[model samples]
Target: MRPTLFLICPVLLFLGLSYLLPFLGIVQLSFTDPQPGLAQYRHVLSDPLTLAVIWRTLRLCIIVTVVSVGCAYIITLLWVRGTPVIRLLTELCIMIPFWISVLSRAFGWLSLLSNRGLINTWLKDAGLIDASIQMTRNEFAVVVGMAHYLIPFAVFPLATAMRNVDERVLTAADGMGASRLRIFWQIFLPMTGNGIIGATLLVFVFSIGFYVTPALLGGGQSVLLAELIYLWIFQMPQWGMAAALSVVMMIAVGGILVALMRRNAETAK
Candidate 1:
């Protein structure tokens, strides 16, 4: 025990200096900056624009979570059930995105989805429409970009759950004349419930904090909470408000994680 404590001391010390201290500083700034009171928190919670941004963030997060999880489920299903070559291709598709930077990925989506971008240009050449569709700088574009980024996050958890399913049970179900769709709906889906929930929550949490993709794709119209936080800190120079918003977001995320932990513990029991 003494040796274990000694071994972990450096890690704990590193975390305290790097993470915990900075977070505490932010919390302190939120409460004490400008004055030692809850004025910043109250203003953030009560302000109309802030409230709108909060709602937009939550709404977009839900949409992105659903879209990402749905696409990831299909991809994970293919990855788990496919042949070696197919699995290899799927893995490449998933991991290639990770190698690319987030900024690059957002720009790539912009190139494809912008008004005069490849998709619109191709559609025009094909004479599908006379005018280019307004795709970029909108909620749709933000959702597409966010979903693309989050799909990989959703896939790994689902793949783990899918891989753990007993193949013998599936074979037995097939032998008993259960249809593929029925078996998947009843057995496979239920077995992967935890993965689905985990992926949804993870994606939602990530979407809430997304800044760049939304900033680029949203064109200032679809501003979310993170963007609002940025605006407060840099543009408006309201450090206290920014810190308060940060604290709020931190609390929300921490609450979610705690709930997830409790749920996992219940499942373990």
Candidate 2:
């Protein structure tokens, strides 16, 4: 035990210096910079624009979480039940995005969704429409890019839960003449509920911090909390406000995690 403590203490000390110290600095900035007090927090909560941005961030978080998790559930089901080749292909599809940088993926979406891009060009040549549809630089485009980026995050947790399910129970249900839909609805879905919750939490938390995709695709029209924070720090040069927003976001995320943990504990009981 003494040796284990010695080993763990170094790692903990390293984290304290590298991560915790910096975080504490940010928290300090929120209160100390530009004449202290709760003024920064007050402004963040009271300002209409900040409130709107917060709401937009939350709304987009929910949209992206639902879209990513729903699609990931389908992919996870295939991965769990499919043949070796199909599983291999599914894995390749899921992992390919991880290899690409976030900036590249966002730009790729821009090229595909832009007016003169492939989809519009094809549509134009095919005489599908007279004018290009406004696809890029919108909420829809942001959601698409975010969901594409986050699907893999949703997939792994769901696959883990699905793989843990008892196969014999499914076989017994099938042998008992249960319809596919009924068995899935009654057994598989309930069994994977924990995974769904986990994926939702993971994706939603990630979605809140998204910057590049929303910045590029939103075109300033659909500004999220992260973008707003950036504006406060660099563009507006309001470091105090930015720090306050960061602290608020951290507290909100922490609160959500605590609430979910309590609920999960209650459910287990």
Candidate 3:
């Protein structure tokens, strides 16, 4: 017991100093404004710009979560049902995109989606549109960029869950005259329910706090919470406001984790 406690104490101390200490300080800063109180949290509730950014952030997160997870689910199904060689090749293809730095990925999208981009060039040649379509510096670009980074993340949790699903059960059902659709609905989906929930939670949490992808893709237009916090601190030097924004982000992500864990626990039964 003494040895175990000694081992845990240092880890606990480190967490306290790193995460807990800074968080508590921020909470204190949020309250003790120019003076001290609940003003900072109130600002979170009342400020129009903050509210708008938070709302847009939430909207983007929901759409990204749905699209990315759905895409991953389909890809994972194909992976699980494929031959070993096919699976290996597919995974290699997916991981190739994953290995590239995110910044580079965003830039790649820029080349594809810009006004004079490859897509527009092809479209113009094919008479799809009379002029080059502008896809950069807007909500469209933000979602595209975010979804690119998020898809791989969505794939792993979902594939792990899908992989763990008992294939024999589905096979047995098919042998007994069940249709593929029914078998997938009845057996496959339920077994992987926890993974779906987990992946959605993980993706949503990351999406809400995402900065780089949206910052580059959306320009300054589609400002999310993380970028808002960054703007407050670096661009505007609003330290007090920045600390308050940071606390809000922490709380929001923590809330996502709590919901994810609760759903997971319920599914365990």
TM-score of each: 0.94, 0.96, 0.91
- Give the lDDT ranking, best first: 2, 1, 3
Q: What is the lDDT of candidate 2?
A: 0.93
Ranking by TM-score: 2, 1, 3
Write one digit per residue (lDDT tens) for candidate 3, span 1-269: 99999999999999999989888988887777666777777787789999998889989889988988888787776777788988987788678887899889888898899888999999999998997787989999998888878877877888888878777888899999999889888888989998898789888888887888898888888899889888877888766777887888788778878977987897797
Local distance difference test, candidate 1:
0.92
Pick the winner on TM-score between candidates 2 and 3.
2
Summarize candidate 1's per-residue lDDT along 1-269 as a digit string, tens digits.
Answer: 99999999999999999999999999999999789999999998999989889888888888999999999999999999999999999999899989988899899999999998999999999999999999988899999999999999999989999999988989999999999999999999988878888898889888889999999988898999999989988899899999999999889878977898788778857
RMSD of 2: 1.4
Best by TM-score: 2
**Count of backbone clashes, every candidate in sequence:** 0, 0, 2
| Shift in Å, residue 91, candidate 2 | 0.8
> What is candidate 2's lDDT per residue for 200-225, written digit by digit as tens?
88999999999999999888889999
Residue 245 alpha-carbon offset, candidate 1, angstroms: 0.6
lDDT of model number 3 = 0.85
Leading candidate by lDDT: 2
Q: List the residue pairs that clash in candidate 3.
A: 31-37, 32-36
